[model samples]
Target: MDKANQTIQITIDADSGIPIWLQLRNRLVYLISSGGFAPGDKLPTVRELAVSLGINYNTVSKVYQDIERDGYIASFRGRGTFVSDAYLKNEGSAENEADSLIDDFIRQCRELGIPRQEISALVERRLKLTE
Candidate 1:
């Protein structure tokens, strides 16, 4: 795959009130966890990503470092960074993947200014509709 083209899928919202680094990191985590990126998939370099997103190189570098530490990606000395297999090992079942996705959803809801109680109520209502 052309890693450069893949960067098109990532976008930054300057008006979102969230930190740019957090936005990038969250998007990457979401992509990886949701299987938009598979294990061993090559990631764009920090410089390339920064250029593509029009952000400072240091910001992308920092997010990469943090995500690498979190075990979501691994960087080889010369081969570039790739999506880590850690999540594959950790999310061994559909249930576990669901749990991770739910955690992401809750975090996003909170970020959107939804209170926990309201989130719970919304979830309950949605579940009832399905039932």
Candidate 2:
């Protein structure tokens, strides 16, 4: 398969029971916010991504449609899809908010008895393995 057809690696817990589409969308948003897919970057088409991930086309399309509605991506007929310009201006603010939210979530996880080192280890492992 072409690299563009490769599946996106999103970190989600299957047992967490979150809907797959939401997980996919949120990870895409995180990528956009982090400049992984910057403004004007073309997104893999629904058919391409679905085949790569071994998911139904309609399922990935649903996520794209919802996110496009949310203003992260702009779709053009017959021209493929690209990230929105609005995303660049708003991404700074969104990244700040996301960072704050993640920090709070980590704190909450600690309060709930999860170890910080475990989280750190997982992040480190992913960083190393993905590289």
In terms of TM-score, how similar is model 1 to the real structure? Answer: 0.66
Candidate 2 lDDT over residue span 1-131, tens digit each: 23253245655456677656667777887776666777788888889877766667887898898678657899999999888866555555867668755764575568668798887886688789998
Q: What residue runs in model 1 are displaced by over 4 Å at the alpha carbon?
A: 92-131
Q: What range of 10 consecutive residues in model 1 has the weakest lDDT sum?
A: 85-94
Per-model TM-score versus the true fold: 0.66, 0.60
User: How many residue pairs clash in model 2?
Assistant: 0
Number of the top-ranking candidate, with TM-score as the measure: 1
Off by over 4 Å in 2: 1-6, 11-14, 88-131
* lDDT (C-alpha) at residue 88 in model 2: 53
RMSD (Å) of each candidate, 1 decimal: 5.1, 9.1
The whole-model lDDT of each prediction reads: 0.85, 0.72
